[model samples]
Target chain A: MNRVNIVGIIVLIAIAIASPIIAGSFFAPPPAFIGPEFLVQIVAWGLIIGCIYVLLASGLNLIFGVMKVVNFSHGEFMILGGYVSYWVSILVGLDPYLSIFVSMVVIGLVGVLTERVCFRRVLGTSKLNEIILSLGLIYVLQNAMAISWTDKPIQIRSPFEFVTVSFGVVRMGLDWLIVIGVTVLIMAGFYILIKRTEVGRAMRATSQNRSAAMLMGINVERMDMFSFGLGTALAATAGTLLAILAPITPQAGAIPALKAFTIIVLGGLGSTIGAVVGGLVYGLVENSTIVLLGATWKDAIAFAILILVLIIRPTGLFGEKEA
Target chain B: MNILSDLRKGLKTPKIYLPILLLLVCLLIPLFGISPYFIHVLAVTFFYISYSSSWNLLAYSGQASFGHAAFLGIGGYVTTIFTIQTSIPWLGLLLGALVSAFAGILVGLTCVRLREWFLALVTLGFSIIMVALTIELHWLTGGVYGLAVPSLLPSVNHYYYGMLALTVFLVFIIYLITKSKIGLAFVAIRENESEAKATGIDVTKYKLLAFTMSAFFAGLIGAFYAHFISYINYQIFHLDYSFWPIIISVIGGIATIEGPIIGSSLMFCIIEFLRVIRPLVETIDPVIKLNYPKIQVLLMGIILVVVVIKMPKGISPWLRKYLISISK
Candidate 1:
């Protein structure tokens, strides 16, 4: 609130973020903190985590952008996608990679179905209705999946499990490379669709003003259902990517989905670059915190940052003031 | 004094007799020889009712907390630690309520200025932070394994009746607030903040009051919940605790007094009845140990979705409408 307070917080955050390197340097004999290899690994892991957040947050933001409806169950959609891909990979011997399309199509349909059945009714009444409705969806979807598939983690053994691609000091698994590549492709595809296509134009118009879009001969309700489906498809893609990267289970979606909310807020709404940048910052900071503090600090730290940002600058870093 | 007389004045209405009748029935249920398990479920439902009421009150001010478990856990841990240290459960509950009220004010100050979604995020974050804090201060609080909290009530019957009474009292107090000038200001703020500001109602003060009051009750019931379960742990901060109140509120109809009371009871009946049946099914055929908890909960979720679709305004309004029609 004051100049001193702002300066004090920045200093405090600096110490919290930098303390790990100092602690690592003094206490451990490995001298690994200053190593380029270690730095590269940190960067690589940050990029992977950040990319996942971007994909997931973008999906959430897409729906937020168009419908102004927040689907808290977006991550569950991803987990459902992950589960479908995991099973398809096992049953059909397809790579989780190829099976992502199956997940996308299936989950997209599921998303449309959910929107038609549940979210549509509560969409505009108030924010609380939509939030609670989504929360209910999480209970149903997560628990149903747990009952059907068992709560155990489902791992689709990667085809590139043992292979590492090296770039000088940076040696990372080929699977990680593929995950990042696919995320970028998805983002690019989404950008082109949003900016360069007819349906994309309709979506933008709807996002701008539902009544205005309706006046322009757009079927606004259809766009709501379409955007919901498309958004969940992106979320499903993130889920499949995560399954490829690590073993996932029914219980895995909540935290990451929550973090994606923080990503969109910090990234600022309706900006592609903002979401990407905010997500990567989140991923980097989250990784740093795990190293500096214990693993338990991860969600807490992100949330702390989110609260701080909301209090200090409610619109976020790149956000325009909402009309 | 004025508020108390106003509360008395409302009792002359025929509608007030329904809750009185319901409370009287609940009071007599234990004497009718229901199982301790059923009593336990009923007691837990009282906690949910309390939570949903508090949540609804906060929502009435236009702020919906997505992580009420933070305040709930705050009350649970503080009360547990205080009671254990000071050997006074009542003092502990009072102190816990005060502490949570203070927390409510802090969160309200930061959040009431921002978009509603940030309030949800901040509260959610606050709960996660509390979980971490409990673990980090494991020496005092007993960490994830949790502290064995002492129950003030002697038996399940005492617990059930005690919870029901406290829940009724808390709701009545909140109801009184909603009827007062403060409650008028809260509604004005909720309906339109700029208009409330334009009209010279201190929007921030009323919102903060609602938040603090809601937090106080949430923490009080949370303390009751810990004692009800006879244990305290970091798991108390789970998102389930946060989500349940929201679900209960919606199921009952948000921002309504009767909604949470009716919603929580119906919810517990459906979920717990299925849960209570699981062992019977398992006993009938040992080979069929159905995962009834998950399945039962899944059934509840489907029911919830259907309810949201069919009764989007929740069951309370429909009940009120039915009563009016029958009366006519």
Candidate 2:
């Protein structure tokens, strides 16, 4: 809204666009013409990952800020979303993209139900109990997925497999472009919903001060559920992307979720913009680490950066200090 | 003159004698011609009980550490490094503990300022980093293949006895710590740190003390574990193992001695039981493929959830309730 904010957004957009081009020049070099198709291929994949992190971290921020509960089971939820997408796609023979909507709605509903039935009761309990309880949920959900779907990896071919775009100098997969486009739309929609809507206002109010919000007739309970539902939906969306990006295994969420935790920390807890920025930073870090160092050391690099960030600035890059 | 008051106080305290009695029963367990496998399981359970209880000492202050296995790795590696090089087994064990406690101090100094979830993340990050370091520094850690430590006890029975003795010693220390005024301070900090600080409780100092104590015992258990297996792999000190003891404490119930004792034993058994299912499935249909390990993990997740939902007070509270009901 302000000049600084506008400038910051522009810089971020520029970086997002430039990173792949720079990466291409260094390693994945194309011909001198550098067609639109080649440009789309690299940028789309990067943005898709960026969007997934955004979804995961934003929900995480909301939960952490409002409930003061770290939902470690978040990765499991995303995996569940992928599973649901698979299930829906198999049953209906519909496009995987359509199944994403189904997964999001189901997960969102599940989130609300869980909040009302479980989390609400544990609201004022000790932090230890809260963590244990969430861990419990994580275990339950993970096992349930295993029971329903076998542990063996399942792959779903993107429907846009048949479609391809050729831009003279390079070619791009249509499915990837669709994933990016959809992700952008969803993220934009989420941003508006959080910043502009009445429900969003209530969420912000509750996150800031629950008791104060309750006194002002904000229905704190409803707000908490709403936030959970939103968070779960976003995670489901991420899961959909993950399903397209990588094959689904029961243990898929384990590593990705752990990485997401680092992003949340580095970006600063409870900040949406921070989640986005952190997600991209993490994505780039992970991608670059893999490129520079072998896969064996990549995990080390990411975690080392996480520990250093925590030691140096625990609040994260974009999180506001709790005054 | 004070007989009634004394009886009431005794009733209010934990039934330590019952567990002590159980320990005696466990001691006689070797007399029965039990399978060597069963003895090994018991020994492993004993190791975890010590490890998880030590973990409780830290969790008691409401700081959930994610890098706990680093201490275990330290203990294991120390035993490995020293036992082959030095003749003194007892000294190596003590040194392992001391080093781990010292490491705890270093970790605490760096990360103790971050409270609650942030602290957990810091420790989690540290644990992952430590695991990476172990693998990366192959000369010291032996990389993924792992290294075998020298065995002090010649027989499995001797190892079992040694583990039992260590468990008893560690449990006693935990008991003493919990019963003391420092344990009360831990509870106060856990309940409300700001209020505790306001009340002149040195929150940081107490937390650091808990961390050091926890690390010392955890390291001892880990070193003992290494001695028992005669091997310490990079896998042993992984983030996965680091998290399990915390889960054991939480599931067993936090800030209680009996909690870890019961939780670790029960979890260890459950893990074994789940593993058994794999063989059963294989026997049922050789052609039918089964990913039992994944299923076992899934079951653990379910067990965690059910425990949280049904028995949030932990297994100790449920056991207490059952015991009291039976008595009544």
The TM-score between candidate 2 and the true structure equals 0.86
Q: What tens-digit string does per-residue lDDT give for candidate 1 at A1-323?
A: 34543454354346435645564455344334647788678778978988889889998998999988878898899999999888899999997799999999999999999988888888887776677678789999999888778888887788889999899878899999999999989899999998899999999999988899999999988999999999999999999989888889998999899889887877667656657666776777787667666676777877877777777776654445661
Docking class of 2: acceptable
Query: What is the docking quality class of candidate 1?
Result: medium
Residues B8-112 of candidate 2: C-alpha lDDT, one tens digit per residue: 676776664587688898899988988888888888888888888888888888788877888888887887888777767778888898998898887787666
**How far in Å is the alpha carbon of B278 misplaced in model 2?**
9.1
Clashing pairs in 1: none
Off by over 4 Å in 1: A1-34, B1-12, B275-289
Per-structure clash totals for the candidates: 0, 2
The digit string of per-residue lDDT tens for model 2 on A1-323 reads: 34544454454445434544464465444455535554444444555576787778877777777777778778888998888898889888879988889999999999888888778777776666667677667666776777667677886678777788866655667776787787778889888988899988888888898899999999888888888888888888888888887788866776677677777776666767767876765665555444434355555655666666567655554445651
